[model samples]
Target: MTEQRVAIVTGAAQGIGAAIARELAADGHKVVVADLNLEGASAVAQEIDGVAKLLDISDEAAVARVVGEVVDEFGRIDILVNNAGLVPFTPWEKLDFAEWKRVFDVNVNGLYLMTKSAGDVMAQGGYGRIVNIASNTFVAGTPNCAHYVATKGAYIGFTRALAGEIGKHGITINAVAPGIIASEGVLSGPHADGFDYVVPMQAFARRGVPSDIGPAVAFLASEKASWITGQTLVVDGGHTRN
Candidate 1:
């Protein structure tokens, strides 16, 4: 039987975030389902018998307050999954500064703020696991997605650097770069339109799902990953491998 632990997963309302929350809860962690979508978050949290929190990852004060609440209620946070991210498809040739900043605000800056606030609590506890969600597009060099790819690239770099700085504190920081997760939003959004033509993932035929990325996150957030940091686990089912 798995030991009971407390976990906080950001962006837990939908897509890969929801899957990760369910996976961790199944692993016996008291999962905290957090997202900007309160109703969505509540639904998932109830499904998993966990708590829900409405959070804007881009806001530092909100991040601090949410993390603080989790610690206060759970007594300890065993795992911190920085899964909140935004993937705005913008071409560099026409990318406006505002649009670029908006992407970074959620993807890059949000990750950093969460780490800063949550890292302190984890450090005090003397042990923690931090699994950051990255993207395989950065690895595959997927075109026409300059902003999304760049933010994820920065996340990978941050994961490695943070791992180096926090290892001594008994916290591990690693990243999971998943291929196209065929979530409801993805299938109904831009990727479903004409975005699939350019980046051909013919080998897999079908797109990757949330469940496909869950186990990787669970592993990285487990004690088994104590010594594994400064690495990016790419789970694209050979989509980006070619």
Candidate 2:
């Protein structure tokens, strides 16, 4: 039997993050639904018999507190899923420095904070599974998202480099690049408009939903993927197979 592991999934309040949380919970893992929406997180956590934590990933103090609390309660963090991020659709001309910085602040800087804090604990335990949610846009290329794509590109690079440093401690870090997923946020956001243009390009010929990305993340967080590290698994219905 696989040992029960403690997992902290950020941005797990709704959409793709919530789906990932449910998958991990169903795998018999003790999941902590950490998100900006405490109520939503609480709902998911309650349904899964897990826990909920209100967090703003970009805030250093909040990240530190959440990590500290998790370690204190669980004694060790076996998994850390960096799923919280901002996906802004800004044309090159409309994009400005402040907007770019905000995107990086959450997508990149917040991810760093979560990783470093959780990775430090994982290192001490000599085992861990760190899965970052990147984007297939970096590989296949997308328009009106220069800033978002840049951050995801950095995420892939970060995963590769961090693997080299953490492998000695039996910790594996990997990236999951999901294609255009039709989540609540996506359907309500500007990206929804592009579905007509984007869905046909995908080999699946249908809109990829949040659940489609969950199993991929759950597998990466499991012991089955122990030998894998520093790899990018694109889960987009073969949208951008790599």
Leading candidate by TM-score: 2
Query: Which pairs clash in the backbone of model 1?
Result: none
| Candidate 1, 84-114: lDDT as tens digits | 8876656678789888889888998999898
Clashing pairs in 2: none
Runs of candidate 1 with Cα error greater than 4 angstroms are 193-203
**Per-model TM against the reference:** 0.95, 0.98
Residues 1-242, candidate 2, lDDT per residue (tens digit)?
Answer: 69999999999989999999999999999999999999999999999988999999999999999999998998999999999988898999999999999999999999899999999999999999999999999988899999999999999999999999999999999999999998878888899987797788788788999999999999999999999999999988776666
RMSD to the hidden true structure, all candidates: 1.7, 0.9
